[model samples]
Target chain A: MTIWQRLRHTLRHGPAPLPAAAPSAETAAALAARLDAAAQRRLGRSLAIRHVGAGGCDGCELELRALNGIVYDLERFGLRFVTSPRHADILLATGPLTRTMAEALARTHAAMGEPKWVVAVGDCAIDGGVFKGSYACLGGITTLPVDLVIRGCPPTPWQVLEGLRALIEANATPAR
Target chain B: MSAAAAIIRAGAASGQRPWPRHALSRERWQAMAAALDAADAPSLQGVWAEAERVHALFLDAGSPLAASVEVDGGSYPALSPHCPAASWFERMIHDLFGHTAEGGRDARGWLDHGAWATAAPLGPRQAALPPRVGAPEPPEFLPVEGEDLNQIGLGPVAGAIAEPAHLRLTAQGETLVRLEVRLGYAHKGTLGLMRGTPPRAAARFAARLSGSATVAHGLAYAHAVEAALGVAPPPRAVALRAVMAELERIRAHLDAAAAILAEAGAAFLETRFGWHREAMHEAAGRAFGHRLMMDAVAPGGLATDLAADGAAAIRAALAALAAELPDLVRRLDRSASLGAGIGRIAPDLALRFGASGPVGRASRRASGHGGDARLVPGYPPYPVLGLDVPTRAEGDVAARLRVRLDELPESARLLRALLEALPDGTIATALPAASGEGLGVAESSRGTVWHWVRIEGGLVAAAFARDPDWLHWPLLEAAMRNGMLADLPLCAASFGLTSSGVDL
Candidate 1:
């Protein structure tokens, strides 16, 4: 159909229906409860994340970007990506920690405020994944004190969310 | 014929496919560098180096040819003085291979930022040293001389969920005078890792070269491997490959549109575009096993055939997108903020960099100089099924977006056609243990992705995968000149260059 017809059809029909809720919604209630308890306890119901890429292929970043889409709606959980490490409550690090980016990643982690968590995302961030044993890489994010690890060549957005939920649940103090 | 192609044709052919690779003497290689000074010179596509030789790929007219010169006494004649596009590649070649470009314009290090344990890690074994100690030294940026100009350093780690790269912007007030991009922060030693491994084992590295262009990279690497072994994949595999490529292009364009809209502060529009992108990803996941389809296009053929109901899932997703795309595009065209002619790239600039894909099409739209690998190098299915190459004469951010918008429907159409005529046959063919050099080219979302591979006894002896971003990154720096600093992100999103793609 011509663009005009498509526009007219849209005007008459309002708009196409939004796709059904993603498969991740099946575990939404459990994840929301866990996120709520942890966020309320330590983060004032909000978590600011700073992403540090340390030389792995950008596959992890792609999945991370998906979290902000309408379906994932990451901010609705009070989780947001921030620009500066100083403003971040958690450092979401990816890549195999290549030597070139090692110092920068270290500085970024050092710059973050206390009570911050380092959540290593992707197998490369855990132990270099496919890039293991390369001369230029340091294997993984060994310089930082990692609090949680999300495993996958690149974990799906759902898996990342589950990993973050677990991070909060493990650290947040129980209500008296 | 272009001087470079003439020289390439005269040399001994080395059995590369789609295009030929020729071994040239030192004198002839120097002559090719001199020939680039002519007004009608072929564009320099890429420059890479191995332990004993350095190679240069060039585009003459619409076809590609490569020439390699043996590195005697550890140096080769520099092409950067004549062709500015070769400057970065020359620097990278020196850094990685430790081969000097004698009389080269820029002698500074490209990828080595002092954090590495050794110098010239990919160079000869004797030259490799033990790991260095302490913090890495800062990279030096070119000096900008002018009155009342201050410099601002942006990254190495900047923006939200973006790969790391340092940007040094020298500005007078709000207008950027010079924007220098310092990359290599995302370098993962991909080439070094690929060496000594079988093509099948090393295909994963190519697929991951750029996450957004995984299918394109994978397809190109698979083609290179197939060419080297003199094996042809089943017809069904070839058609399926095209299907995945078009899907990836459609999804990536949607993501680029969303980013541009988001930068323009069109929240509702941005979300709508993101919604479409999410649907595409879902469709890909349902069709293939992976959301990104990483490692799906393996050497020989495919890792697996399409899942049951894959075609139905893909058709549903396309129908949904088709219903919404026109209205969304109309809304975008009507938005004054998005339509403003910001980030204009001249056609000459695009041609000089050998830009391809949407960015090249948008810039060279009026000139009709843009060439898609699918059409030029002539791949199967694409040549028969045909493609509608979209273009926009404006060469600005809006023009780029319009080109992308125009491409979405065409891709949807192509996908539908491909799915309808889905070939029925064995999905894969066994590859034989053989050795040769081959070049594989694929038109990716960002631009053309070229993978050059040399196999020896069924193992990858040397490999270089050049993403179109190597050219587009330089174009981004050029386009940002004299523009408002605030528009940098918007302009970059429109170009859609990836840092990790070239950081390898």
Candidate 2:
């Protein structure tokens, strides 16, 4: 294709956006159970998340980065991965909890304001996937309450976005 | 004596070219270092220590044979001062196994941050240490003395999307005086986890060692086990392994290019490249079960054979990537501003640091060794198909980016060749129960990935998978010296080094 044609094509017909992944029924019900009308009013549409790599291979991190790519376009869903945990409403973490990074992860979670939710974004974060009982890692953090777990070797971008949407939608409902 | 001749004289065996082992006293080992340094193409493959012996492996640039030197006892003379490439390996051996390199420079911990449940988790006496308690103090950074220098600590946690690494940059004004990288925040004790497990079952640990280089690690581990067991995979299995490996290379390079473009402030190019990468992942997902091709290249062969439809889908994806790649390259090359912020690494620095893959290749130095196992004697298919190794003399971020871009076509060509020549045979061979040691090497996206496995009573007694990052990360430090502090991230992105790969 010619440069002009390529430019025109990009300008006129942008790349296709990723289709939303439908979350499981169980996930939807769990979100509904946790959130209520009062919670919905308190938490608005937007969720600022701070992501932590406690101790992970870059698989989940790459998938997490992909969530913000042109294809996934997570910004369109009012879910932005913020730089600071203090401004975040959700702490999205990947990797098993390694002792070296444990304090950092705790500090990050502690920095987030109250009413914050934590979403474990891969099998490593849910429970140590391959590095389960190794001397170096403690699997995922159990000290803090976890709100949701997205499971995959490195969960796809859609799974991450879909999980975030569920968390945000839970904020849209009233807590019991 | 020539390194090859030394190996031959030491009784190197035929089949996978077993490393000729020569046990030497500390004095002799130190003396051999001088001889290796005086050689035209001196190189250090890796330095590792077991319970009773510390070993060093060396390979010359053009030689087919590898020499292993064993130094009995807890300490061995350091090779880093003379060879330079053994710096991190010695540090790692000290931390992991408590084997001190008597004269080694840089005694600081490479992968230990002192927060382990027990010190020297891989050492023989690790079980005797009382369990660790309470959060340990943060790692101490080695000080760079200067009147006006101030340090900028960038991460263990920085931006939300960033990996876990601590970069201590001592700078005078905006110019970097020295950059010391403290990694190991992502350590999972993968090597320790492989102990006592059969090689086939333990293959999962290798696959997960570095998520991005899963196929390369898998192939390396598989090859190690195969070599140890004296089993050769079927021809079709080899072709399938090549197919998966090439697909991985395609995705990895695309990801690296996209990251470099993003760091260069070319968001358009980043997004376009990212789109292409995702499309490739989608294609890979259809062909293999996972987008990253994780565990697809299993021991003996693949986890499963590719169906005719899977082959067609993979072919279609490669065709699309091949068609669009040239235009992408043209646009990237046309951008004069893109190369402006790249921190320059000298060829000698790359050589001294034992840089591999694109990072080493960009330097265009004799030290930039293209140690692809496929090209190694007795390694099949690659020699038969013919492969091109690309290199450049710039040793800057742009050169590294160019190398990555240049490699895309080669990966595509390999993919096509492998697909066309897909042989008819079973996809896997049953592994033999054995007790022996073997070495595996494969050309990963970044560079040569090496795995050494020792099987005892049908189980892996000891295993080590060395990522290319072990060689590349030090080069990052040298590249950052005398560079603007702001350009460090761009330079890092171009190198595409991973903490998990090295931390393990």
Candidate 3:
């Protein structure tokens, strides 16, 4: 096909439909409600997440990446990943805290501004999961004050969204 | 004699299956190590240690061979001096097993950054040293001497939503003079964790060793266990395993292509690839019940059978991908920015590093040493149903992208063929409670994944899973030499090396 024809085809077809297994509208609505309520109180309708991979496998990191893709569209829900911890309001950490990374994780949490929240993603981050007794790891993100924990070998993208919603709701004041 | 034949003939035959493994005396092992510098030396695949011996895996003229040397007085002759690829593994062995590589190059510790409570946690000196009391000292990097070169350290955590690894780059203006990757931040003592556990239990760790290559690693681990027990998974299970592997390769290649496009500032192409990747993952979830297919392949057979509608879901996803792939490829070809000479890997360097999978295929192209594990050390179902391995000569970002693009359809075709000929039988076969040593190799999206397992009485005695990143990371370091700092992301994305896989 010619370039013009291809462009026309793309424009007419639009993007492919999302998969059938994408989270339901009600799930999205519940998350939006929590985000809205949190914004009214203090969050301003956005949560900037700074992800730190402690000592776990890359499973959680993969799921977290999925959240930013078109399917999950995490940014649409006012959540986005940032490079620097100082710019973040929520520190999203994964893995069992390896000894080499324990200090770094602690420092990253400290760099965040006050009223910050820590959400540990994955079973390893919850309590070291499969790596619990390994000598090289501290077995979870316990050195910092953790406000939320999402558990799975590596939690799915939807589970991570729910955890974020729960974090906002728990800290969010009741709608006045 | 060939290095492999020499090593095998010199030592007493060990029980390792599907590949010959022999236990050699220190002298013979040193002789073999010395021979590694020869022009026709076998390629070093991996190196790891047990309490009593240090083992090395080699790929000799498309055949897998293993050799071990008993550690006398907790020290053995090092292979790094003869084989540059063995350097990292040698250092890692020293750190984890407390076995010194006598006269080894770069004696610095690897994977242990003074963070562990004890030195050589897996070694004989596990409790000999006093616990570390203070904050660990900063890691040492090779000093760069140049008037204008300034060093910049990036990540144990970096800009991307990826694994943690520290990259130290010495640069003159925007051009890198040297790039040194200091990893181990993601080390969870995976090998130590697998010790003494049943193969079924330890398979979980293998599956998680690199989440992106879950099926490949899991399949390799299963293959190793099956080999050790002399059990073969049912034909249907074998075909399904191959099916899952192809699905994984397609998804990974799409993700990789998307990452490269995103780094190159081609947002439209990037989004399209991302859409396809997510669609693939969703199909996997629908078919196998997990987006990543984690823990799906177990030691004996599979954890569960494919869903009833699994074939339909997979076919639909592949059809959509196939429909859009041509336009995507055409657009990618027209984008001059991506095709520019950036992050190019030389063919000689690729061969020396034993680069495998798409990375190797891109560099080596049609020439020999396109180290696809499935082809080399041939595996089931894949061999029975013929396959085509893609090749590209450029070895740049564009070449890697082209290789991946070619692979997507190849994988899709293989998936369709496997589905059509999907055999009907039990999905699992029980492994006997037996003892033996086995090595398993699988071609992951990144490259060849090697898992070495020794099962003692149905329990894992000692194990090591070597991800291809272990070899490819050094290639990335070499590729980035003298390249612009801004091109680092594109180079990294093109290589698609995972830190956790190597860090473990």
Candidate 4:
């Protein structure tokens, strides 16, 4: 199990294959259908997302990590999380919006180009979830206009992927 | 004896027994802090405020006993001047409760960002007011000295999959001179929200305090409440709690390994470790109902039970992990290029911060402060089965990584022991809504996590949960001193400090 052995094994086996747990063709097409004709034309097939953790408990962060792993492999669906909001078509936000992060969230969303969409990703983001009346949190992201809401204390990776696919379809270019 | 233990012995030697509600004059409180610093107690556990007084909680690394000192007023002389370990705790007390540590060194806001509706949100009659009055002023950070040092602020919004923390690094060329971490971006008013809520419901806030260590926090919160009510969970519940806790520990270590590997640029190894962690989560989900096992460890007992089928599945998962981990570790260790920049931490710096968990263990291996929650007296199942603790003396990134790898098999062994001897009985006991105070401690994946609670009239009056990061984060600055800037990520990842854990 040494590095030499690992290199040997890599030489013998080659690189690992792309993950097999991709979204079904029907699911992809349906997601594409959700996009309006004009929006879809503008966005095309690829979607870049910028994630902002407003004031979360870290459950959603863990789930988001899972989506990138081999089990979910979110990149296969033409969706990728970019580091900068300017490079993103969607802002995928998690957590109850703490007042401290409200300005930052707004700035991030504002940085996204025109036709940018904001998707609230967890129960906390959709409303307040358990953190609902805390003085620290403003419940959801009240500072920005939100387009999509995905609810769960922390939605599972599959659920997160489904939400992403839906966002793509909703903004996808319509067929002729 | 260790310095901390000696301090406790000497402090208590006068024979005036200091109980839970031990009152001290301002002078006595200041003198005690100075004495403990001179005697070298590990860290101040927490500093909190009640109706009209401020209290400081202290723990000796070598003993289970906790000492509390109360001074009547909104301010007391700060302990940070002599004992650097109490620095953040004092600032936090000032921020949250408006209690001043009169002569504390750091005056920066530890939790408050001026975004709140009011100053001192937890101060007398302040909770009812909204936390936002107008626009918040930008937070201030201390500037690093020297003309050569250039500052870089990393986050509050990071690239991906990270809790919100502003890591302000002061580097001279490519060498780091200082690392100042600003948290509270994820502070959800957890303690404030817990007040007035019944223990059963307030337990969720504890679990959510840091999702990665949910079971430990949940169990600790439960223990605090049970202690206050003067009740012990049924034997079956205690055993079941142990199962969930151990499983959590295993999963967290796997995740930490994956993070460390990713930082080391071992892409394939990182993914493999992450996959292993995912398998553990899947098994946990099948057995319990949540991936993080959230809400499963509730006050008084478990929220659910582990069925026979679930037990078998968990056993199979552990077997798979046990079989796959060694090969992975051996491959990771033998990679020569990855060994060059593994960060190094000094034992004295770690001791000064009262570091715990893997970070502390790797610093001074023979120190025997392993952050074992099972070490706390009166905890069941663990004492009988015993703990298989691991330590590495190098105090470098590689040493910390090795400590985690060593723990994987040890945790697996603990899980197997618990599963084989599954106790049969009621999984939960009803807790009465009563008034009292208690401290609950648990060894989470990160390290020893403690929750202190005071319940009154069937509602939580006050609560404090300490993440081991409180000790480790300060030490990180020292660890990074004069080290290459490129090694910062790996060093931070190796420590596995959490923002929400401390920010809360």
**DockQ for all models, in order?**
0.55, 0.72, 0.60, 0.62
Q: List the residue pairs that clash in candidate 1.
A: B117-B131
Q: What would the per-residue lDDT of candidate 3 be over residues B1-504, giving only the tens digit for each residue?
A: 576458656788888987878888888898888888776688888999999889998888888878999899989999888888988998899889889999888788779999998888888778777888988778989977869889999988887587889999999999998999988998899999899998998998999899999999999999998988898999889999998999999999999998889888998888878888988988999999998999999987899789999999999999988888898888887875684688899888788788898889999735455768887788998777888888888889888888899988889999999999889989989888889988998999999999999999988999999999999999999999999999999889999888888878
Worst 10 residues of 2 chain B by lDDT: B8-17
lDDT of 2 by residue, B308-328 (tens): 588888888888777777777
Error of 1 at B146 (Å): 2.5
Error of 3 at B339 (Å): 4.4
- Name the runs in model 3 displaced over 4 angstroms: A1-41, A166-176, B1-8, B336-339
TM-score: the better of candidates 1 and 3: 3
Question: Which has the higher lDDT value, candidate number 2 or candidate number 3?
Answer: 3
Docking level of model 4 = medium
Give per-residue lDDT, candidate 3, residue A115. Answer: 62
lDDT of 4 by residue, B1-504 (tens): 544344344443211111243455566666666765554554565556655666555655444445444434666778788778788888888788777788888988878888877878887746664656666667788856689779999988875667888988888999888888888888889999999999999999999988889999998788888878787788888988888988888888888988888888888888888877888888898888888899998888999898658788789889878777778877776784563445677676666666667887787745555455576443677888888778777788888887888988888888888888887889888888778887777778887787888888888999889887888888787788888898898888898888887888
Please give the ranking of all candidate structures by TM-score, highest first, separated by commas.
3, 2, 1, 4
Please tell me how candidate 3 rates in CAPRI terms.
Answer: medium
lDDT tens digits, residues B1-504, model 1? Answer: 877668778999777775778899999988988988876788888999899989999888777878889998979999899888999998998888888999899999889887777778899853546767876666888988889999999878899898888999999999999899999888889999999999899999999899999999999999899988898999999989998999999999999989888887888778878987988899999999888889999888898789998999899989988887777777776775674679888898888888888788888745477688899876787989888787777789988888888989888999999998988999889877789888888989888999999999999999999999999888889999999999998998898778888989
TM-scores of the candidates in the order shown: 0.94, 0.94, 0.94, 0.92
Isolated chain A: TM-score per model? 0.75, 0.87, 0.77, 0.78
Better of 1 and 4 by TM-score: 1
Shift of residue B413 alpha carbon in model 4, Å: 0.9
**Model 1 RMSD, rounded to 1 decimal:** 3.6
User: lDDT order of candidates, best first?
Assistant: 3, 1, 2, 4
